[model samples]
Target: MRIETALAAVAVFSLGLSSADAETPFKLGTFERNGRTFPGLVLEDRWVVDIAAANARLQKQHPSWKALAIPAGMKELIERYDGGLRERLHAIANEPGAATPRVDTYEVKALRVRPPVPDPETMVNAAVNYVEHGAEVAGGTQAPTPSPTMAPSVPGLWERPANDIRWTPYLFLKARSALIGAGEAIRIPPGRDKIDWECELAVIVGRRASRVSVGQAREHIFGYTLEDDVSDRGGRGDARHGSDWLVGKSHDTFAPVGPFIVPKEFVPDPQALAIRFALSGKVMQDSSTARMTHTVDELLQYASNILTLRPGDVISTGSPAGVGFTRNPPVFMKPGDVAACTIERIGTLTNPVAAGP
Candidate 1:
């Protein structure tokens, strides 16, 4: 009798716990505007939509489409989530006396749906971290760039922008300003020559870390996202004093990150993903993460040694073989072309290239 009673109590407790867990309100719903359906945040109907929906409506309303200016509040939301911000936004939506910007009146629809955490900082990209890219760029065999002294200080030391000779694990900073949500248009800067696309797996930092060990490095990661390190490959591959990677790589819409942030809990083994890229709907770059010369853990351990990586910092663990510049005939992006970058678990990030400033 006693044993039976204990088992019953255990079952009851488990049931109660599951019931309680279900109460955690997570925003989930489809965002629909002007008769079109797209994934969107689920805020209380009162939340503002001007920034998210305004431009979409305008683009639909007008023929001359302009990129929607990122809203001011978007930054605040990203900052909050960067600090482990997760909660039911509904209470803020439902409370009679909650913050203003009510549901129905807001410009964007606030249907309930989970949104990604804003990255705390921009992506710290390890350039030519792959052996193949290094070899191709050198126009010779894959001779490794002498690994910089494995210390904690080397990551921040490489602060140059894109499109330069990356003899080492040349690190560069992609402006947080350069980030674009998935499915958005990637504006091709005007008067640009040699626009090339690189498919890379970007690691998202999960926790505060400094000098983390390689074994513990994966724990500091939240998950991963996809980014196209679109660069002006023309001047960059020159093997000269300064290839203009910075201006080429940092163009307004050069970096397209998203589809969604695959929370780390879902991806147990990130190093083994398959990454592929398609241009104008044709497969151009195809390879696996296994080809990476520097593993994700090595990259993280090396980066943390240099700077304090706060939650939401991203490291784009280099691209695989088959970048456009590496092609026999050299395939470059042109206007009216859609480039698709796919990595296992992270989903596909597709953007239509448009001519713009």
Candidate 2:
């Protein structure tokens, strides 16, 4: 579909409404059935419509129209998203019995719900981006005292805002191979105890971005999804090199992302959502994105200045306080435990913990 047509369709479907509106319909994700993966539209009662198949049918019906050719995969859709594809999707969703056998649809419970972007180029994560989380992880202590009688600080000598006690959005890279979808197992590697859960709001990059300013960062975001930044607290580096995030954070199935990816247009404010997670039906981390010290735009701007962010790159915008490692006596996820992370507007991403080989 033409980009303008697609955009107009989304406008008609959403009526320029925010996701918080009760009338907003449909969320997006990827699903697997019989070993075949396709983009899907999440429906009521754990059912989903295979959009790729639906688009194929639409194309066959309208051979003369060139605009019916929608992107086949999530990454392509995001990378090329203009208004046309979204509008086409809205039309497909509005079709009567679209989720019925006429279109390829399946009960989500009977199939696998994979990560929205199954293969991102890079997954960048923000560390301690929330004030309370930074304090909690630092044992709620104050910064060390500066030497008494020190000379008055010069501009270069004085710490910049980015380098001061106020935590900047410290970014780290996670292995894309570690990603798993909702309902998948987060296998706890043997001998690595203290596996903790961090429910974070993850942003999916829609376009190529490099050195974008904070004001322009929002323009490059395609959508928002939930991510559980699973960590092995015991694997952190000791007194020498400090915490080894790669070893602690990058394990197979360490990043359990998505139940769905809500389009950025649907989510009006990325920093105002309520985020929470539970372990085995017991609520653990419960907070709002409002508590974040550095907003999603700031984090994106910071990271883009350092390196290029291509389409399908994921930026995990940090978790709130209440992580297990910061708790008294430390609590961790054990095998057989279920971890569920939820964000308002965005859905819940639940994964079961299993013993690794």
Candidate 3:
């Protein structure tokens, strides 16, 4: 069968798809081998196929294929994929004999995986984007208050439209320098005793967008990945600017991102994915993206209204109701503990906890 024929067969995609049946069925990421790093396509969730090398081989054998030049990095790939570059990727994944002996392939278990997008220009994180989470942060018992008496408590973000339309997503900028790849360590900065974890679905931008409408926001999205927005709840140890986020969210190794990026096409309904995080083998945060008080498109539209979102920027859509700082006695991450964030379609991002000076 022709490559195009096979490609069309798998082209039909939908809301929820296992990696096996979806188009491409693979994700894009960066892997380290022989002490060097390069961008590659992770296939069947086990093998890493070197895009540049594999494409060159496919070209030598199939001269009729109109494949564009392999992108030098993940960011470049995102920028060019929609413009006549995705077909070549489809051929690599769907064509039966696409993997030639000459094509470079490595067992994922044998190599080191790095952050797919090492340096996004910016990262905007949402606060209380989930109602149940808002309840937890506000000192509730993880459920909404059915009856309010004195001060008019949070009605669990007050119900959507009633909330989503009246309220804009609360966002904070996190320094890109805080990013750590999968399998790395989430270090506790010196002098901070209360460290917390925020597991979120990170939306990756594919285009340069400024003032875009909510309807057009989806067009600028590239894919989805996971990020652990590690936090330092001990404040700056003072009372000045009690609302300062930099002191709590911008420490190095605080944002643990990646494993890989599943293209938006594969994830038809980002809101349908299951999001959960565990610490030291215990499940802590568990909820679905459907609980998000504001949808991804609405968040993008609001953010683009303030600043241009360029290719490779990330938006952490917010966490659910199980953060450590708001617990009964409060549970915090300590040295030697491990944290793992897993999204259904996107892979898991695991990192160990450490104390740093």
Candidate 4:
């Protein structure tokens, strides 16, 4: 499809106001019950409105009105999301309490919170997409040394000016099975000692996209969520290749995502959000999405050109500087460390570290 036509299609599907004026009316997630998962509306910090049950109630009154299909899951909801579904959800959410049906209400503490898109078809992550992060990964500059008989030399540093660098995003794939939800334990595997944390802003794709342009990228996005891209630095490389991201990145519980997915309308400017993470009570990685070398749209555009992006596929834009491995004393997460990744507008995803079996 023509880029403009594709963009217009996205606008029609977007349930709320355009990103510029979109307020986060509500958030979406999944909660477990009796070994089954149900899509839910995050009404508040500790409460959720079960969309599946609410839709069933609505179906009884209006048999033909099936905005939220029965047995709805977050993945299915994203695929069928539109203005009508948004309105129906808003109506149910705005009803007066006590008078409203209490059967659909659930406390956050009483159930298991699953990943926003628990079964994403694929999970793509950007590596070193922040300028400072790239430089730090490459090893920062060394101070100029003084010479006994000659002038001191200038320090050597890596530099990539805007005009000199290509706008293309460098992307990599992470295992879909690596996903773990909020409050779950990120088990540190046996024999791997250097486990690090990379707090990132994750983009959830709402539609199927292939060869999409940057202008239409935002429309394809379902919403945003927080992801802690945990890495096993010790398993990063071996003799055959200098770097093996699959080994370093795709371990079980390496990708801790969610808390919930906030729709794009709520996030006016993805680039302006403050992204940070704290280990235990100590702030470790702290930065802003504004520092990213490639914007969300640019990354999506680049990825679409290479492969088709399906609904529920996640694209983690990238992490900022302050990763533990790059520090002077190189810090890493240990068993019992609680890592919490927080992004502005979105929410925090906290997971504890445990030794793997």
Alpha-carbon RMSD, each predicted model: 11.8, 4.8, 5.6, 7.7
Question: Clashing pairs in model 2?
Answer: 1-67, 6-83, 6-84, 7-83, 7-84
State the lDDT of candidate 3 residue by residue for 108-219, as single tens digits. 8788988889878889999889988888887765634333232332243222333223344688999988988999888888778799999999999999989887799899
Each prediction's Cα lDDT score? 0.60, 0.79, 0.81, 0.79
Candidate number with greatest TM-score: 3
Candidate 1, superposed: residue stretches over 4 Å from native: 1-119, 141-168, 236-241
Model 2, range 217-296, lDDT digits (tens) per residue? Answer: 98898889989999988855466687688888999999998988887866889889999989999999889999887789
Instruction: For residue 293, give model 3's deviation from the true position in Å.
Output: 0.4
Q: How do the residues 194-263 of candidate 4 rate in per-residue lDDT, one tens digit apiece?
A: 9999999999999998977778998899899989999989964456868788878989999999989997
Which residue pairs collide, candidate 3?
none
TM-score of each: 0.65, 0.86, 0.87, 0.84
Put down candidate 1 lDDT per residue, 1-357, tens digits, no spaces: 333223333333433333233222222122344654443333332343333443344345445432333223322433343231222122222223223454332333233221233434656887887777777777766745544433323354433234333343556777766676655677866676678888999877767779887789887876677878878765645667766657767877777776555545446688788899999989977888888776788788778877888766778888766777777787788889999999986677778888876
Error of 2 at 231 (Å): 0.7
Clashes found in each candidate (C-alpha, N, C closer than 3 A): 16, 5, 0, 0
Query: Model 4, residue 16: displacement in angstroms?
Result: 19
Q: After superposing candidate 2 on the true structure, give the runs of residues whose Cα lies further than 4 Å from its correct spot.
A: 1-6, 9-23, 59-66, 99-102, 141-165, 236-238
Name the regions of candidate 4 deviating beyond 4 angstroms.
Answer: 1-24, 58-68, 98-101, 141-164
